[model samples]
Target chain A: MGSIHLPSHEARLACRQNRLTNTAGVAPGYLQANLLILPAQHAADFHDLCLRNPVSCPLVGKTTTPGDAHAVQPAGCIQFPDFDIRTDFPQYRIYQNGEYLESRRDLLDVWTSGHVAFLIGCSFSFEDALTTAGLQPRHQQTGTIVAMYRSNIPLLPAGIFTGGHCIVSMRPYRPEQIDRVREVTRTYLSTHGEPVAWGWEGAKQLGITEINNPDFGEPQVFEEGEVPVFWACGVTPQMAVEAAGDRIKGLVFAHEPGHMLVTDWTSNDLDKLRPGII
Target chain B: MGSIHLPSHEARLACRQNRLTNTAGVAPGYLQANLLILPAQHAADFHDLCLRNPVSCPLVGKTTTPGDAHAVQPAGCIQFPDFDIRTDFPQYRIYQNGEYLESRRDLLDVWTSGHVAFLIGCSFSFEDALTTAGLQPRHQQTGTIVAMYRSNIPLLPAGIFTGGHCIVSMRPYRPEQIDRVREVTRTYLSTHGEPVAWGWEGAKQLGITEINNPDFGEPQVFEEGEVPVFWACGVTPQMAVEAAGDRIKGLVFAHEPGHMLVTDWTSNDLDKLRPGII
Candidate 1:
């Protein structure tokens, strides 16, 4: 039962039935998304935050209207025909007043009609493109989640979502390969396009003090002459929620870090789904 | 006085003093923006509407925080150092509870700390590019404002901003010129990038029944083999506010059509200022 080759629908069904726990490599060609559900009252501000900080929080799709669990395409087609927002993700992390509560297998008991669900594009989609281009990420070779850090890069604040910094994921690449790496990643605009910074000086500029001790995910070992390249991480919205302190009232739900929602869209759909192309 | 060759700073000064009213050809190389100011309570929802419909409401610069009037860059630099949002636009249209009130020379009496200002990218930036590429819009040749019409294209609703259709500006071009037209406009991403529809059949698909009788701007007289080419218009947000029908409360301010905010950024700055490039 290797899940990496499963189609998107079957992979999502496995998560719903509690058969799959980690979604990193599952549904290889399909896009994976980070989930963030908030009360309808707070949906606008969070949506604004994502739009303002698109590098870190590239929005892919969301419920057609507040409280609708089904994510739909702009043309009104349901992106995942049989998808259930509450049960499709392998794990859900619940937070209240900006403090973590606990992780749940599903949101059956927690989901309310008042909640608005947002699906953010994840880096996995671009990683697939990179691998196809023969630039396998270091974390993939090491069998670990990509290293993540909180950078000093400030997010453009929106209403209650204030006082937050960007969260970034790191991958080691040879200095000479940097140009090609950027060219490959920049095409996946909705999934954190291009590297924000690179090299030791770049990390220090972002105020990252300990390169080995990441704020999230496993640490990676860098080889000689290989500089670190940082991409805006999907975990940024989570940090924004945490930084909001008591300003975020009620409950907020997000997919547990590495366990993402496998979407029906593929890397091939990227160009057509761009913001203004339609 | 001639303003097409004026520097951005000086052009903004002229606008502030009412010395320049129509910004169509002013500050030739600089970017111009459509203005939308709402009470803080509606800011998030309107912001969401803009994000959901980037082709029509491409947001470029916005106030640093709610209730602040000065628009700033991502790095905290004031986009126009000596600019004042309330008086900088040549004219302002006032709205209350989704109904048009009256036009004003300035918002000195209406502006308050509870208002949030947003600057949406206008098609003028791309029109400049099209002209530079020898694809001058028909309106420029005819010496009239571009023709605009309300299309049946449904907008992605957010919160209280619902039931709105897309508004588009039209320019007639020969069938063969569209490819070059799209290439020229697509690079100006923040401005309404590329034509959403073209030709008679394309316009019909958008449910635009009255091509010769535009809802706004003077109707264009098409020549032989010339077809209507439509691009998303900045006026869509205004229509959304109108369609909200009392869902919008307090006061709303927008630039009178064709009177926009000229900023310090130039066409060359576009690629660097794109989302996530920072």
Candidate 2:
């Protein structure tokens, strides 16, 4: 609290103790990721889906064993120290074989050694890149969850992770800024790179309806030449997790998108650093 | 012939007569691609090879007909105008079942109705991004081809293409520039983004040698703060074609080292663009 730039770990810790319960943004510079914890059995298919749907799920970090938390990286990357593999996130969405069960605050009710969690890359990382480049996200400026839409485009499926349409967040920009912003965000996002689609028709194809009214974030005015630029959201994976359901059983992720594990690993590491480091 | 930017017709006229026999750098704004012309019988395996070895052999365009020299594209953005596909290239390398039979100035001698030509991406498209960002390539400064080495890393093999150590082109960059260079190229290079290896032991791992020496191009200096960054060279497809030796009949690519087909598609169009335009 006294000397920190990003407070992801602090907030997660607070939430673990029931003192903090809010949507992310509490952490500033540190990367925020979507969590997808599951058992070892579905690991390969989930891994394949992330690989196939790289634009939507450009993997940040993962584990081989179901509960081997230390298997994440070359050690010393988790910011909050040795974490409990079973009960780290603030909330949990439990499903029974692809059916919605209920969203619970604690998994202590059914914790086990057979589960593994994944920390996925989020657009939050690019929010910093955008702010630094003076292309601050319009949704964040208005304090809203950026609009996400189910698109007509189909995702390349993996195993049973089927039929999840791409979910995207939009940011309006002048046509000129589109290419430059493309250069900026891509340079920072590393794994996923820049906007996969631009132009109004691409938005329309993705099921976006408004130029000014957004489905997720605070509605903002498109002054002058601003046009909507959309990127596939990390929520696609959650949809996959939900679709996989509980027959696969014991799936886990950060609770309600509020709790996230801040890691010592740089999400940009594999993207920016030489692969030899591994 | 005297104009600054030669139109498609003029460019072909000059190319047919051997007048425009150097690098096609002026036709530089859009996509430039390598050409691989083979018989229809071998197209399936070759296409499969391109699909498997996408990084080094990004298939930009291809002909569905054995001798058709046209390609269909997305909603008309840019296109290679109708020009002679046979004589458009400055040089052509003739391969008879993987053997380097001869190098010719044009394809006039072997133009056949049963040939299918493929257009592949050139690394130069990424160079535009480099210069646009004010990053100067050391090889360009020294005025030479970037030094290329055969690395010990085995390529992902496909039918007719056997796995062997990959051929790599090396560019020495200071540690800081690695991230920038990697990110910039990664945005447009498809699966070919980022450096694969960068240490002294890197060459040996790929079964390549003469650390300070090279098999092709002039030596690149690894300045005090720089480390050599290795990328899977586009010449990789050549390796596959060579390995496919005698398994099929004829094969050839356009003449001149960097000379390639300029497509009507964007390098960003990871799928649609065909082999050679015209």
Candidate 3:
């Protein structure tokens, strides 16, 4: 009631108390991570899933035991964002064993101990770096969502995680300018790095017709002269979660399409956190 | 006569014909570049001075129009390379306005058309790339003849061009990792991209120890953790032509560092390229 525009932690506390849902554009600079709250029994398998499919789920942080919200890595500035996991996210998919259950925004009633939580890295950070480098994000340029395509390229899976295809994000560029892109994205390999796929010949294998069915978002018309480059998307994990037959229950993910957790980490700082830096 | 393996081109023609002297290794991947054989008439007022300044004194294919050997891009690739000034590379430098400068392995007696030639772009094509990627020439890594030093990084002022601190290549790293060494070499901006400054930190305002100093090549130990990086030794250019105190000579610039003659070409053949694949 005071001033909805500039809400403080106190307001966030109140919101939690009232069970206000939806996290899009919340805590801008601080990370708003994808949460995978699973029973302690499935934690190890989930952890392995994260390790294998790092691009889609670079393991930022996770809890050691079930029901522990305070993971090693925090997506946001706040420690163990206190609130009911069941109902905090704008939506949640309850899967029994792996079968579709029901979607609910609040998991408070279903909240119980012995559930592990995980937070992963996303493309937002690198995208931020690109903007600073003067490479304008094409999606932002068009004021449209980056078209995401389900790729035929399969994701390497961990236990119970199977049949997950890579979700790709494409950006168009002329051949000569690719050197600049490579120069900018070179250091980012640990996060997302350079494009995983390029050229039109390989597009067909990914089920991208460049003409056929429109996928997730509007396709930018690639000029005859430019190459359509694609990067591995972070949505692969969720796709995998949907695939595995009835093992994961009470799955949690960011409901907003492009909304992602923004961490305090910077690419330069990440350079320090890497093995060589240490 | 010496137990050696000179490049086939040099062995078959220049070297065997006694028309070439000095190290042929430097010109291996590059076409044999030459200078002009010009009389003193046209070598006056800035134009003549331009030829001697290392930056612009490119390997002139011919002096006086048709007296020298012309080198190709990838060196030896072009069968009928177009060149006329006079003579081939091994050595070619003549001064009509100045003193009796007779330095030519072939025709030291004749000065055709009295036209002076300029020699430039001494680097072999993409060999820098190969080196950065760590492609070690089987013979060169040992106690070899690559020389390096700290020249006062200098500039051209009208008649004269000052030399900078540079290396003449006497360093060596493990053969196995040379590919990576080559990879980084391609990125060096000298002659092409912004060449890696010879020394680590610039000697800004003096009174500081230059990093890559104490002569050429990394810290002799270069241990397991180190990587050997390189640049187009700036001295090579500065030394190509002598600094004639009074500006009265000829001018030229061999080729851009990478010879990036942008063709009206588009390559969907990503398979043909190495680094950009993924």
Candidate 4:
């Protein structure tokens, strides 16, 4: 638990040694990324999917080339140094032909040159921004993981990756604070960005009928006059992989829910790295 | 030449009918893109290259899926409607096993389901911004094409795409107007944003020796107290294709240098569509 206060590199070192189980609060201001590793053959389609659905899956880093795991390529710059995709995450979930296999502390036994690692932006990166704006997330206040749900919003399908829904993470905010929340979170582009929907009506519009029952993470208690604000979740790519099923010919690996890769970049770095205007 | 003032769809229609030869000033305020078409096998690596080198290749649109030409996928939204990759561009240059083949008005004779089309951001998109700021490009004032050069800066390699240099386009501006020039152009993210290098020293840093002569497009004269400004060019991917030589398995097609794909989207639409903080 004390490792949460460490810098990104030290936290990653802690993760490598199995000293940490979850990275929810680790390295407070650094960028935390969702992990997804796939076979080289399926890499292109998944890349195209990320390009098409950036809000759901904003790419932060990836292996320089297929099978090379040491350096990561973030937007605009060539190298994110001192990182190993295989051992940097606290834990990894293994899936084969769309079915869950098991969890591992590291991918030492399974990773190969045929694999390509991708790092997607995580909602955790924007949590600090919310707190800084004095709008603490209800789940964080209750000391639990943020609530995530599968929405009725269908993603634009790419290649054999089809029939996937946009998974969203929710946080409770008062009606008055919603605008400020949007103003704060929207700047964290590499993260999930602005809320996709807000209020109870927003939830209904997304077809999320089970408000209190989340597919992942613990449910939060809504205060009086509070509305549920939803954002595109990083879990989307995992669901996309599952929907593709046996069409995916090889093994898939992702960060265990609540456990992520703490990156060398920060939110400010991402803002600067965004394309076009700075 | 009258088609330059037409709407994007009508301009594309004019291009398809061979009524247009260049797209430099077509459909003012709309986005114009550089075209790169590759066989399905080499598309992935080239996509990876674009990701690694965004300044030289800011992707604005691409085919929905491999072999699909009717729709284009920009950043956030799923589709840019009514686009035909094969015929929308005024002209295309054909290459075989990396060697220069021929130029064609349309790819109808060589079209196959095995090809993928990518639309990269062109410097022409920023010319409108420059003009609006009262910093008209010297090339445009002289009624000539922007001067393009092969710089010594190398691109980050991706798979089979290697040994490629960053190609650049040059425009001259008065020394006093340089700061305003950057402030205006930097906001056009979908277009090549901001000058990568400026002044004679900047050109020297890029390893361009002959300032008066360029590899492509006509040369422009620098006035007294004016300096050369360089931005990452859309021709980079083409030069990369030439560098890779026969490693590319099948046919490759790119817009004839100055002829581009006029898109339905505008600069304002791109600003709103940019990921994060919009």
Per-candidate local distance difference test: 0.76, 0.58, 0.42, 0.78
lDDT of 1 by residue, B147-246 (tens): 8899866554555675667889899999999878876776666777667777898788667888889987788889999999888888888888898878
Q: How large is the interface RMSD of each prediction?
A: 15.5, 15.9, 21.4, 16.6
Residues A176-243 of candidate 4: C-alpha lDDT, one tens digit per residue: 99878877776665676777778898788778988889998888899888989988888889988999
Which model is ahead, 1 or 3, in terms of TM-score?
1
Per-residue error for B86 in candidate 2, Å, reads: 2.3
DockQ category of candidate 3 = incorrect
Docking category of candidate 2:
incorrect
Enumerate the chain B TM-scores of all models: 0.91, 0.81, 0.29, 0.93
**List of clashing residue pairs for candidate 1:** none
lDDT of 4 by residue, B92-204 (tens): 99998778899999998887889898888888887877788788888777777778999865554555676668789999888788778877776665566667677888788
The 10 consecutive residues of candidate 4 chain A with the worst lDDT sum are A269-278
Per-residue CA lDDT of model 2 for B56-130, tens digit only, reads 565555665787655422222244555456777667777777777877888866878888876666665566566
Candidate 2 per-residue C-alpha lDDT over A1-278 given as tens digits, one digit per residue, 9 for 90 to 100: 33553355565566567564434454556555566667777776676566445556655666656667545542123333445544555566665565556777767766557776666666666676678778887766766556666554445445556555566667778888887776665543323446656668657655677656644434555668778877666666666766556536554543454344444334444343211111
**Model 4 misplaced stretches (Cα beyond 4 Å):** A1-278, B1-6, B272-278
Candidate 2 yields a Cα-based lDDT of: 0.58
Q: What TM-score, computed on C-alpha atoms, does each candidate reach?
A: 0.54, 0.49, 0.41, 0.54
